[model samples]
Target: MSWSDRQSPIVAVATAPGRGAVGIVRVSGRGVAPLAQALTGRTLLPRVATYGPFLDADGQAIDHGLALYFPGPHSYTGEDVLELQGHGGPVVLQLLVARCLTAAAAPDAATGRPVLPGLRLAQPGEFTERAFLNDKIDLAQAEAIADLIDASTEAAARSATRSLGGAFSHEVNALRDGLIHLRMLVEATLDFPEEEIDFLEKANARGKLDGLQAALQGVMRQARQGALLREGLQVVLAGQPNAGKSSLLNALAGAELAIVTPIAGTTRDKVSETIQIEGVPLKVIDTAGLRADHETSDEVERIGMARSWEAIGQADAVLFLHDLSRMAEPAYAAADAEIAQRLGEALAGASTVIHVFNKADAVATEAVATHLAAPPAPAGQAVALSARTGEGLDSLRQRLLDMAGWQHQTEGLFMARQRHVQALGEAAEHLALAQAHAAQQDGALDLLAEELRLSHDALGRITGAFSADDLLGEIFSRFCIGK
Candidate 1:
């Protein structure tokens, strides 16, 4: 949006678009008091909820509601804000919004001009974006507002709340402060080339760099976990028909989410469930069995297999299940080998593949151990379990948590996005370069200073201290309207 568009007074239905106990129409911009007075037919006490009838252009009561006014530089958008809370029916809310527009456009008796010129409807996330722009909150906290709304688990919600409360931004600012101090020391020493190294040593620049790197690593680790919580892993199950793929999904989810049967090719489409392990959400997908295309003359089975491969290719992890009971059959073994080769080609090391040996109850203990000893696909982790008995499921859950890099600690953790993680990664890379420079016997003070600056800039991106307009637009655009 242009500067003028942002400057215009904006209004939106603040509550969700549905029937509820109450609904709200929120307006924010400079000089909104007149609009408030015009809407309510009376001057509203600042920050006070005064029950009154919202008036129309003809001075008729559109709806009876509570009118609240907040003066500029203190409200959510750092502008004068007016809120009208009424009944939650969608029709009434829209009527109130329409009244607001009409009232804003109507001419005033004093100057015979629109009461609130340039009043418009708010775009998605414009309110929160204004909060960020006004310094009421940082970019990270603004993102946390959406994260909190979209959080799927209790842990995720708590983490998002922490982030919205500025826990993550505080840590990032602390790191940036340290980097600034170290950069000051290094840049100041660059003026005296002869004593640059001695000055850095005396100022403990090397020790400070080490400390920043350590702190960055700690933050990086937590950010990874937070990102995992935000964007959970996609795990796809693949194997030959009747290899217990559906049964395994049911077992992991602890519910019969997928229909399991002795018949082959029962699941012609993907059946997915999101299960949480140690607060980390894992979307487990059960796909149709992989078989020779010629073996299935049915077009639906062929299409299902194609989609299964598609899911596998896009998955964060693929569970290549093996039926221990069928491993002894020559045809089954050959088919498993072919599927493994295709899986290897399909994934191309882009995703991890876990070898799951199912139906252990139907196989001998020695046989299960032998297969587990050397899985068909030796690259990823292997597990032997019985889906029907729910045996060894804990081990699989732990494996997933390990793959997610979850340390099982949620306290004080702040929700983070992939961009935040990438920014931290970039900062860490620069910090590593700074360390390499400092380790040199005759370190290049200029190069070291440049690295420190780059790292600081990277950290600044997280809090929006150094952010592009496009990035800001992209981040806030995902938020719901009126946020």
Candidate 2:
């Protein structure tokens, strides 16, 4: 939206659309006190909730509720804000919103002019976007607001709350401060060309750079974990028909989510479920059993197989299941080998693969042990588990966590998006170049200063100290209407 558009008084139903005990209609802008008085038919005490009726233009009660007024420079968006809490029936909320617009546009009895001019409906995320623009919150904190609302797990919600509370912004600002200090030192050395090396050495420029890099690494590690929490791992289960893929999924989820049967093509589609391990969400998918084209003459089964490969290509990891009981069958072994070869080719090292030998309870212990010792595919970790009996599931879960790089360290860790991770990575790259320049015998002060400046900017983007308008729009646009 344009700058002036954002400046217009905006109103929206702040509560979600549904029938509930209460709903809220929020209005924010300059000179909103007059509008509040017009709506409530009395002056509202600033920052105090007054129980009353929300009146219509005809001077009649539309709804009995609570009204709160917050004056400019002291409210959420740094603008005057008026909130009306009423019954949460969808129709009632709509009427209240319409009433707000009507009240804002009506002529004032005192001046015969609009009570609040330029009143309009708020766009999606406009409320929170205004908070960011007004300095009430930084970019990361603003993002965290949406993250907290959409969090899928308790851990994710807590981390998002921390970020919204400025935990992430605090760290980014600290790094920026360090970078600024180092830049000042390097730039000063650039001015004194003759004594550049001596000045840098005396100021301990290399030592400062080393300290900043170490701190950056620490933040990067935590940020990666936070990102993992936000975007959970996608795990797809693959194997020949009826190789216990469905059973394994059901066991891991602790519920019957997919159909398990002895039929080779019982599952002709993808079945997905999100299971949390140590607060980390893993979306496990059971796909149609992988098999040779000639083995499945049915068109539906062939289509399912095609989709299975497509999912594998997009998965973060693949579980290639092997039937332990069928290992003695020559045809079964050859088919398993063919499927393994196709998996390696399809994944091409893009996704991690875990060798899972299933149905151990149905086979001899020695056979299971021998197969585990020498997995058909020696590419990744192998686990011999009986899905029907729930054996060895814990080991598989731990291996998945290890592959995801989760360290089980949650204290002080804030929620982060993929973009935050990328920005930190870029900053680290710039710092590495700066370090290389500082290590030279006759270090180039100007080059070092430029690298530090670039790194500083990269970090600034995280907290919005340096950000593009388009970036801000993109980030806020994802939020639901009414924030």
Candidate 3:
């Protein structure tokens, strides 16, 4: 929806859609206090939780709950807000929401004030969108609210919290302010053509642009790390049948999530688990055995093998497991070579391939040394581990983290989306063009000014100062209702 369109009061069940000990039905926008009183039959003091029975159309009690009223200009969404904390039954919570809509529609007999006609069910992320439009929070901070709720790891949660508290936006705003200062100087020099060159040179505009470029690079590095935490690596376990793929899956998950057996082609399907390394989530997918198409004529095994190849194709990283015990067998070695060639072709330059040698306990140290010393894979990593004994698992875990490019502690990180990273890159590109224009002995003043304006516009997009209507809609549409 357009930002200029007037908004009406909105209501929804803010809690998860299930039974719990307690649930919340929230209302926000104009006449929230009056609506609260209409349902409660008592004046609700601002910012206080008043306990009472919520009445229906016939003054019959619908439910007992706590009614909290937050008056306008100080509440969430920068409007009057009310929350009804009630029992956690799905029907009970929905009934409370129905009561809110009904009350918002009813007119007072004495003052002839009709309930807000616009009061209705809230759309997904509408509340937060209202907050952004009302100046209660900026666009980045609004996105953080959803990010904080959807965080899959402790590090992600902490980083999202930092962004919600304005860490990311603060950095962007500071850079924007510095850029604005430089733009003012450049544009001001254009008005007087005589001293323009000497004026820009004397002002050291190039030096200031260099400093700004350095600062942008620093923020970009942190943002890249934060993006990794939000969108973690998808690592798939691929190898021949009975190659200890399931055992490695269990070891990484710290549980027997997949069945382990000695039977060839035991795992005729894919089993997945999510594990974390240094608070970065890794979705580990253990696929069935990879073999020649005709060798396993069993219909199920053939399908499983095809799926394994499919998973390898889309993976962010592939952990190609090898059984060390079979490294010396001539037939086994030939099959291994065939699989490696297929992997090289399928993955190409798209994914990182890590060579993991499993069943270390079954082979001697000298044998492992001779095996690994042969040749390295094309890319990614190579490590040896005993999934049964849990040896070298630490090395594997750290290797996955390195592949994901995760760094820094929670306190030093802030959550960022891919869009934010792309925006930063666009701004950097514009700034570089501006720098080139400024460096010329007799540069066109108009071109230099235009480049600076473009850079400023790019930076402002992050904070909603120069955002488009469709972009805002796309962003808020991802959030769940009543956010």
Candidate 2 lDDT by residue in tens digits, 1-483: 798998999999998878999999899999999988888889999999999999998889999999999997899998999999999999999999998898888899999999999999998899898998999999999999999998888999999999999999999999999999898777876776686358557878889989999999999999999998889999999999989999999999999999988888899999999999887889999999988888878999999999999999999999999998899999999998898888889889999999999998998899987887785657458888889999999989999999999998777789999999999999999999999998888777778899999999999999998999999889988988888
TM-score of 3: 0.96
Q: Which residue pairs come into collision in candidate 3?
A: none
Cα lDDT tens digits, model 3, 143-257, are: 8899899999999999999999999999999899989998888787887777635756787888988998999988898888888888888899998888899999999999999
Tell me how candidate 1 scores on lDDT. Answer: 0.90
Off by over 4 Å in 2: 192-197
Best by TM-score: 2
Model 1, 270-315: lDDT tens digits are 8999998877889999999999877889999999999999999999
Ten residues in sequence with the least summed lDDT for candidate 2: 192-201
Compute the lDDT for candidate 2: 0.91
